[model samples]
Target: MTNPAIEAFVQEANDILETLEDQLLELEGSSDPAQVDAVFRALHTIKGSGSMFGFTRLSQFTHHFETAFDLIREGKLAIDGKLIDLSLKARDTMRRFVDLGGDNAEADQLSEAAEVKNLVAALQSLTNVTSAPETTEEGASQAGAASEIAVFDIWFKPAADDLRNGLRPDLLLGELEDLGDVTHRLDLTAVPSLEKLEPLQCYAAWAVTLTGATTEEAIKDVFIFADDSELEITKHEPPVAASEPELTTKTVAADKGKSNKTTAPIRVDSGRLDEVMDRLGELVIAQARLNQVTTRLADPMLEAVTEDIERLLTGLRDTTLSIRMMPIETVFGKFRRVVRDLSAELNKDIKLVTKGGETEIDKNVIDKLSEPLVHMIRNAIDHGVETREGRIEANKPEHGTVILSANQEGGEVLISLEDDGRGLNTEAIRARAIERGLLDANATPTEQELHQFIFAPGFSTAKELTSISGRGVGMDAVKTTVDSLRGNFKVHSQPGQGTKVTLHLPVSLAIIDGMLVRLGSDVFVIPLSAVQECVELDTLETNRESGRSMLRIRETLVPFLDLVDVFNYPESKDTRRRVVIVRAGNAPLGLIVDDILGQNQTVIKALSVYHRDVEGFAGATILGDGTVALIIDTAIMIRRALQQAKAQEAPSKYVAAGGH
Candidate 1:
């Protein structure tokens, strides 16, 4: 039989060991006594947990690592970077040993073990020989000395979430057989009635009595499955035999589990959740068809049933979407390792700070966002922040700050990567753009337009491409990845201040609340959150004297993008037009449309591989009537407008000054 308690212990141990190893590698250049102490605690936790789980091999191996580090802590061994590297390698070997089930047969495991033994030998040469085991309070406690035993009792209280993690109280009681003739007692005062039962909640506690060879450590291991449980272990001087009629351990244990087996939490896989979403989508479509039929029949009962089904479908969809949400921090947390390694390699003093990490995004989107975030951080350190000496000369702090934050705004998650460093160099960027043949020789672009040139392929302003950055790889990759996700990316900068890159992504790409609209021959879906208001466009009166058209909304002159001109659609040949006002970043634009089709809950489907690169089309969604409408990529459209705005602004500046 597989022991879940031991397996959980092994998994926890392995994860902690990996973190320790990564931290040790990060601590190579640091001489802080506090960090060394932290490293010792990590190894100590692994060793203690390993022995508890019966992984004797791992415990033995980690003991040596712990001893060597203890020597360093005590000043017996000198601190050095090479030693830290060796310790990190040994940590990796011990992880391999734990993974190998502590068996010594696999060639790779044997090789790693041999390497660890050699490293241990090298470390041992720096220490004085100890003929006998070192005596510490912990060692004395484990020795079962006659003076150490105390007479008391233990109360193990499991939390409600403990059972949801696959722990069973009765099964844990069964494992207590090793500590002598043990009697298990359980408390079950919180069990609710069947009607109010929640399967995931734990409703009991345990009391165990054991004799002979039993230590507090031994007793605690029996409840390994209940790690989050509140364990009160009062040491008893001698193992006491069960005697009281009211305290018969078997009777208490049996009674506790007897009344309640009715509910257990159901575990559903991700594939099943996706299946539920698909069924909900079909029901939504079917409900639309039913409403259409009922309109012709004018049946009252059919209308009521349709209303009920709509409510249920809406609930089912919400439940399914909630299941797919995971905190963005999971991906964001790994950047500590990246920042640590990059800072060490570059010899730069940089601190990473993250906020609003609890904000959730679609699981798929969070998974893909990691690479782009890493690239941006790397770019900030390599090219954005100045060198330590140079930064001081520039009257800035030596340690640069990079902040990654995410928060939900209405229906989309706004993630911003900002750095307090030198902003983009417009003169250098403009010159590079000309060198790359991306701009005219005599052209002068505004700061905002100049910043956009970095996203173009093979654009680098770095004097030479170092390992850290400047190879023209990461920025374009960020653009492509964000574009693929139907998200928008923007850059804002001010000289001598800082740069901020913002990414606006839908909460979940699979589904959204959308507003459907039509423009000439094509239909478009605007994410409902971005829609401010819709109004009629009487171009004849709204036209500028220079032939430009703008809509005045709330005393703001918002430029209107004629979808017909942008998409090359066949003109409606109508005198009047409808405009949908959408906001991206700080700018709002009026998108010309033929008609406002109604609100919809849309399930977005990605375009075919060939159409993936198509501009302005975020994704495709099927309408209630089965027509395919393209979801609008608002960010790309905004960028295109910005480019056009810049183009229209040029030449007129020189003419205004009478220099043309």
Candidate 2:
């Protein structure tokens, strides 16, 4: 294997290690036979492949660790807390050995060797317990019984260069003979004419049949050193009532057994896929350039071909990109470990139920979302799930429930975190708002109004300082992080049922479908998710609302925000107005614009630091016409509109009370 292959092996080995660790951790608190088998298989695979890749130190360490797990697998050792703890420690040590290359360095080797020996001794003692009556006497008897089972039949025809490369066909056959009793037959057919055959060339085919007490994997171990040379092995199921003569096949011998599925198809790495996508992107841009260059040719046939090329390239690009798309389940699986550890640490009984984990999203988006997800999970365990006694008083289940789910809707993906515990305390939240001076003492805030305070900077409701919560930060940072990825965040809570936080993120942050609109002298782009509809605004006369136009859509009055006032745009003579209905969470507002330009496929670029603080603008994008357009942060704008609407309604409250 080359360096890249080695790195790939390391990555796969690390994933298996993580799997083993998590299984052991769960087994520490409970006894599960399935978990034991899973842990053993993971360690065994690592040991086998580690040796194949020349990581001798890793192979030796994992081999010893696998024996301990094997004892548990065979019912000789019952797993306990002490065994699980030592297994986790040993797994970590194997990781270190893999990361730090060789065993020749004395200082590191001495330390690791001591830990390995101690863990091995502990494991051996666990297996040495006196025989329990539950164990059947026949189990050990079955281990010694020998039964010959027919394995695979192989057909081999080596190339002329096989002998020159020092690969002897007879040597492979001899290894098979050691595995079990074998019958071999040589065929001279296709050997070619003797006058044309070279002395250094090999041209012979052979068939062999073998029977053994071991598995087919034991047979493949013999020929691991050979590349895909002319060799084929087919496993034969033993006959029940009828008997027939089978063909001769050959098998090789090795330390470990060979697997029947050794020649499985290989998959490309994401880095290679990314490289392909990059080239495809360039192809798309070049095709766009070609369309531009050919427009002046005045040939309909050229235009037709260009259109065909465009369609082909678009299809190719989408196909290539879809290869890198994976289900969100790959990421959600890791959180099981996080929740288990946090539950134990906080002394909280928690169960995590996940749904819609198979929802597909861009791989890049998944990677960037991991850290924010970790934070959300930690917060759910620390603050969202109430303590055991607290739950009983509230007439809820003593064990709290936290749910993580992902679903794809339209062009965006929605990830939600929900818990069944005591909900956010709005009274305490409002008091904190006043104490922090975010609101005045005289200010009366609604329930929805109070919940928004949790997203304010340096705002949290926890009273006492603990390692988990009460650090004076929470939703605000989560909001900021999601916003950075061009995503939207919303929080919902009932008085006692707990809280639900939803994240709406684009499938790919690099590109999106946006609607172009003109605001004053500047052109802006709004994501499609925010746009409900576009309509002509009519003036409202019943309320005698001045300067503001309201549209009645679906039997509800939607207020309009004038872009001229918000953006401070220069004067324009076109009085004809258009309303772009936008939504954020449950709130919707109409954005009044001078013109609604059409749909655009936008590639987003970041705004400079000086312009990042500009409210209501998330990022900027360049159009095909070489014009720069700003993308609106519709969530912030909708929140602002809600507050503005509330303030506008305050006058009616006083009027109803006769203005005392």
Best by TM-score: 2
List candidate 1 stretches off by more than 4 Å: 1-215, 218-272, 520-522, 539-559, 565-568, 610-614, 641-660
Question: Candidate 1's error at 230, in angstroms?
Answer: 15
Off by over 4 Å in 2: 18-38, 52-54, 79-93, 101-124, 127-142, 146-299, 520-522, 538-560, 607-616, 639-660
Which residue pairs in model 1 clash with each other?
Answer: 150-236, 150-237, 151-236, 151-237, 152-236
lDDT of 1 at 165: 56
Worst 10 residues of 1 by lDDT: 651-660
lDDT of each: 0.71, 0.71
What RMSD does model 1 have?
8.5
Assess candidate 2 and give its lDDT. 0.71
Across 118-164, the per-residue lDDT of candidate 1 in tens digits comes to 87676566455454345557544545453243333667777777665
Q: How close is candidate 2 to the true structure, as a TM-score?
A: 0.75
